[model samples]
Target: MRIEGKTFLVTGGASGLGAATVEALVGKGAVVVVADRNSDAGAALRQRYGSAIEFIQADVTSEDSIVKALDLAVGLSGTFSGVVSCAGVAPAERIFGRNGIHGLQSFRAAVDVNLVGTFNVLRVAADRLIKRDRTGGEEENGVIINTASVAAYDGQIGQVAYAASKGGVVALTLPAARELARHSIRVVTIAPGIMETPMLLAMPDEVRASLAATVPFPSRLGKPQEFASLVCHVIENPYLNGEVIRLDGAIRMAAK
Candidate 1:
């Protein structure tokens, strides 16, 4: 499960948590395929990392798109050893909002991207990993790291769709790991609290500070690198499987 000399496919790797992971993995001598929809950012990453990384524009909601991305990973490197699914969207819309009832399309969109999209990548990557030769003494073939949210457990107001999608991710981890055990591929999910990603940075300074004050300790937002560090640990630790690790800074969000 060591990262050195291994290959990984990182979805939504052009920025935020995914970007940090791509950089961290490459720094450890692992070949990374950056799968994202942002061509400009992807190109920037390729330019920054050179041959250590490859950029593939992929839509996680589509099976064909993810399959093609996986194929590109094999073509770029030799085999796929890991996958990190970070492609997700969070839109806050109350079911009974002042504007109107939440749109059904919004709910479906979140679930499709966050939940179904994750499964799409997992199933395809697991299949490819299963076909590969086992490397470690533990017979480990691959690892899957999915991104969830603390909202899955403690969703606040205006997060009905977002919470449901993340809840599904948290719920899927154990069963996925159990089923994929025979193939020696591990599945794990990370439920992160408020983090200092691009999405959060867009908020006004006062708003961001208010959000930071919610964390009991550290009193600041989580950093993307911290999340990336945990991912590295999960990859190197074979026994760590089928579990959801919370990277929140002891923060339990309140209903807004």
Candidate 2:
């Protein structure tokens, strides 16, 4: 699938990995629709890219909200071809802790935002792609990329909710791909480990360094641009479907 001249929708595109992806897509001559809850960041991005970027303040968990963003993307181009679901929340809590126990609402919030939110975008995007009219040489109608975390596999003691939510994302990749294959829509998930996102950046220097040291090689935190680069590759590589690719630098997280 050629990225140039194409239009894509990127959820959580206001910051972190999603922002990097928006930049990469625009740099590659693709128009991008940024769907995020951050209005300030959306304004900044729209200013940065001008007409190349269209931003909609969106809630990934709501189908109506996602539909508006999708409609905006399709409006920008004749048809929107792909979506990268990077909107997620990570909550740390133990099943039984000093706080007595994790709140059910918090657990539900994590799953609702991270897992269900991702599925919402996939389903809505798949529907739109399926209805699109394709031209010759268009082998695939669209691609759906989801964001998962390494915690899904090597969850630490306090990451029960976060891990379970991401674990669900990992579990859904293959099935989603298989179901969407007939529509020529690819589904893939990316599980990143210890990236330098805003949450980690707020930690003390020593703490950040300690986390970086956990990676076997590179010995540094992953960059959002690197993740964006991988996203571009995934979009271009037609064969990479129904797979969860770990973007970790050979790091297997230890139990905390």
Candidate 3:
């Protein structure tokens, strides 16, 4: 579906990949609802984008929260055209670590926020889109874009919980797309490799550089804008659905 004149709800839109996506969508003339728990960042985005974007404090893991966020999207823009599920958490902890056994709480938190949270947003957004009147022939009602990580496929040591969470996201794509097809909604997931997000940037310079060197081409961490660009492309491309597109620079990570 064309982005211009449409509205999209972006979870975790306050920062990182989600922020880039919100900006990209607004730049393309699409109204965006920035659903995130970061009220300060959300307010800043709303102030910067004015009417092009709306900010709603939302917890993606909560059904009531996301439902309200989607309602707000429609109330602000009159309709919901798509959603980009970027709300996630990545906690690196080995099952048996220097401290002790990996905490069950940490594992549950990762899965709850990364995997289940994605589905929470998707179901609510898809429901709204499916209820909308289609613009007629060959017109898609909406699209859902989810975020995974290259670790889902090539998880290194100390990434058990994170990998499991992201792996669930990748596994969810195909079935969701198939089920939503009857309503003209598309579901796709993106598995990004090492990226220049805050989590990676927090690493020491030498460490960061070492990681960047792993990428086969470009030999650098992926940019959030590149991720956002793919999201826009996926939305506009009707034939691209039910797939997990890896945004890594051909890097197959080795087990640490």
Candidate 4:
């Protein structure tokens, strides 16, 4: 799909990877709606990007919230062409550990925000795309990109909830693509490793350095811009459907 003149909705667009994606998309001439729960950050983004971006405080786990975001996107650009779901929560807790058995609420929170949130955005976007009349000669209707994590494949000692939530995202890619094919909407997931998000950046220098060393080549934390670049590439590449691409720098995480 052409980036220029198209519209996209980005969940968690207030900061981190989602913020980078908003920048990239706007640079490419796409109108983007920033959907996030951080009102202050959303206001900040709006101030930075001006009218090129729209900010809507949204929660991806709520269907009503997602619908409002989608509505705002459509209002801005007539209709939106894609969505990049980046809203997620990472909770570190062992199943049985010093903290006692993991709380069911915590586990549910991870799954709800990470896995189910991704699905909520995708489903709502897919429905909207399916209902819209196809533009002549435009073979693709829309793209849905989900954010997973390397933890899905390499769950460490304290990542049971996070890993399971992300794992569900990894598992749903192909099926979503298959079902949505007839509507000309594609689904893809990106699993990033040790990204330099705010959480990681807040760590002590030595701890951050130790984590960066885990990556095999070009040993450093993955940049949010790099992930945004892949998102742009996936948006333009017509045949990259139903795949989960790893943005990790050949890092196979070790159990801690």
Candidate 5:
């Protein structure tokens, strides 16, 4: 469970929470594989962290890319002890629109990225871990932390597509964990509320403040470091499996 001398794969490692997790792992003496769609961002991360990090350009929705990513993680460093699936898209749309129209393609795309994309990383990573060698550690052969959103449970009006995709992720956690238990790999999810990631950081200050104000306690956005810290804790603590931990601060979203 110790990160020292272990390896980890972080999908969507180019930016946002993924980037923060990568940095955190690296700081703890772990070698990291940064798999992301943006080659430039990956390159920049590599440059920032030097040789401790490896990167592969991959699309989470494609099986071929997932294969390449897993292979690269092993080939470039070695078998990974953990995987963090943070690759997701948050596209907003309603099932029926104001004009009585809906874009099916857009809805499907949201599902593809947020739902199916996460599963692609999960299944493939578990397969590789099942076949790889493990160090001596109780209930700690490997770990997978998936990213979900509070929207899955409390979706606002305009977030139908985004919410549905995230909901599927939340739904899959327990079953996935139960099935993978025998293999010594643990599965868990984190449903974050309002985080000051790039997506929200790009919004105006007033808009961001309004979003943070929705949180009843602390009344502010969650920090990416807080999420990363919990991930580290989950990895160290062996019994925290098959649970979806919400990182939202007492904030249950309302219908917008």
Candidate 6:
């Protein structure tokens, strides 16, 4: 569980929470395979972290790509201690509406990445983890960390599609934990509140302020590193399993 001297395979490691986790783990001496579709960012990360990190371009939505990334991970790291699934997308929609409602395609795309893609990573990584020998007889072999969203619980009016996909992720944690328990590998999810990602960061100052004001206290968007910290904690805590931890401060979104 100690991040130091271990290898972690992280999807979406080019940016946001994924990038932050890679930074934290690599900083602590953990070797990493930063798998992401964004080759530019992934390559830059490799440059920044040097030997401790290597970038792999893989689209999480494709099974073939996932397999490739997993192979690359094994090729570089020798063994993996953890798999962090941070690849996801949010597409807002309504199930039904006067203006023809949201497109089903949009909804399906969200589910494909946020939910199904997560499964691909988990299934692939857990398969390897189960077969691999435990480093120490007293503890688990590996960990799988998933990303959900606050919208799963408190979705806004236009977030039906996004919420459903995230809800699937939330629902998946328990079942995965149970299934993967025998191998001593833990499965967990983090449902984050609004974070200052590139999109949010691009908003006008007053608009961003308005969004921050919605939080109950410490009115500010969550930081990617804060979410990464929770991941680091879960990695080291053996007892934490089959749970979805909310990284939101105190704020719950109002129905928009």
* Tens-place lDDT digits, model 2, residues 1-256: 8888888999999999999999999999899999999999999999999999998999999989999999888778645789999999878899999989899999999999999999999998998899987876798999999999999999999999999999999999999999999999999999999999999999999999999998998999999999999999999999999999999999999998
Q: Candidate 6: TM-score?
A: 0.96
- Cα lDDT of model 1 overall? 0.93
Model 1 Cα displacement at 228 (Å)? 0.6
For model 6, residues 147-170, the per-residue Cα lDDT tens digits are 999999999998988898999999
Residue 12's lDDT within candidate 5 is 92
In candidate 4, the residue pairs with backbone N, CA or C atoms under 3 Å apart (3 or more residues apart, or in different chains) clash, namely none
> Could you estimate the TM-score for every candidate?
0.98, 0.98, 0.97, 0.98, 0.96, 0.96
Q: How large is the C-alpha RMSD of every model relative to the true structure?
A: 1.0, 0.8, 1.0, 0.9, 1.3, 1.4
Q: Encode model 5's per-residue lDDT on 1-256: one tens digit a residue.
A: 7887878999998998999899888998889999899999999999999988999999999999999988777665544787999899988777788867669899999999999999999999999889887756445679999999999999999899999999999999999999999999999999988997998999999999999888998899999888888888887888899999999998999899
Q: How does residue 167 of candidate 2 score in lDDT? A: 99
lDDT (0 to 1) per candidate = 0.93, 0.94, 0.92, 0.93, 0.90, 0.88
- Error at 178, model 5, angstroms: 0.5
In terms of TM-score, how similar is model 4 to the real structure?
A: 0.98
User: What is the number of backbone collisions in each predicted candidate, taken in the order shown?
Assistant: 0, 0, 0, 0, 0, 0
Instruction: Find the 10 residues in a row with the least total lDDT in model 2.
Output: 71-80
Candidate 6, residue 250: the lDDT equals 81
Estimate the lDDT of model 3: 0.92
Per-residue lDDT of 49 in model 1: 96
How high is the lDDT of residue 118 in model 4? Answer: 95
TM-score of model 2 (CA atoms): 0.98
lDDT of 2 at 29: 89
